[model samples]
Target: MLTIIGLLSTTFGVSVASALMPLISVELFAVGLVLKAPHIPWWALAIVIATGQIGGKLLHYYAARGSIRLPRFMQRKKAAERKGRVREWLDAFRANCRKRPAWTGVVMLVSALASLPPFAAVAIIAGWAKVPVTTFLVTGFVGRFVRFGALAIAPGIVSTWV
Candidate 1:
């Protein structure tokens, strides 16, 4: 029981770190962890990692929404906010999201699974778009759960074939 608790805590910390720092590959960590600790159930690993990921990502969402102030060095410059293609596009997207709020959740779900837009970027965008907290939590958790669960089980599946 102590071992299980320790592993869970370590995995949660890694998951949060990966979410905050994209350079840290949580996918690799998950696969290696499952291989090293096959006794850990995939569902348990998924739940812990997913929860940690969402918890870290919430920080980005809040910062983007202007709910959190970043350090001066980390904050964007006023010139960077100049009217340009990306700025115009972001404004339009936000407006569209307001008219169809479900679209934001759909995008969040897809990004969480495939990471086509990058989950971190989506997290900030979701915040800037003012996506509801409930929507972000529900969709992000569900998507991350499925993603991590599959990854956590891949080793066992491949071992059987080998």
Candidate 2:
């Protein structure tokens, strides 16, 4: 389970996060039910997933909150360019958030569904848009509950297939 959590924490790198979720869910759900460990209940598993979303979003927030000035040796051509687009997009997302504060929850929910690349983009946008952290956490919990609930039940339904 700790290993699964670690993998999830590292999923910020790319689409690998989305790809690995199903496998992790299935494995964790199975292990929890099979071993029936008193310390690790099914609900706790759900919380891990739910809380993980917040952690991922925080990571995304930190990554996008700042503009890095790369050192001469390690800088790439691409890194040196595109400040305009990044600022533009961030500005637009902020404007959109102000228009519809509630919609940030929808964005959080959709992000989980789409498995959009560099998900931090969305997370950063949400934070910059001034979406309340409390609201983000609540919406994240709902999204994760749905996801974890689905995964928890899926093993039984697909028992024949697996």
TM-score of each: 0.91, 0.55
lDDT: which candidate is best? 1
Candidate 1 C-alpha lDDT tens digits along 1-162? 349779989999999999999889889999988988899999999999999999999999999888999999877656365678978887788899888977778988999887878889999988988889898899899999999999999999999999
Tens-digit lDDT track for model 2 on 1-162? 545544344322222243233334333533454244333344555555556655656655544434434357744345446588876885676787778876767777766544452334566665546676676667666766566656555555566586
TM-score of 1: 0.91
Q: Give the TM-score of candidate 2.
A: 0.55
lDDT of each: 0.90, 0.54
Error of 2 at 104 (Å): 2.4
* Regions more than 4 Å wrong, model 2: 1-41, 66-89, 113-119, 160-162
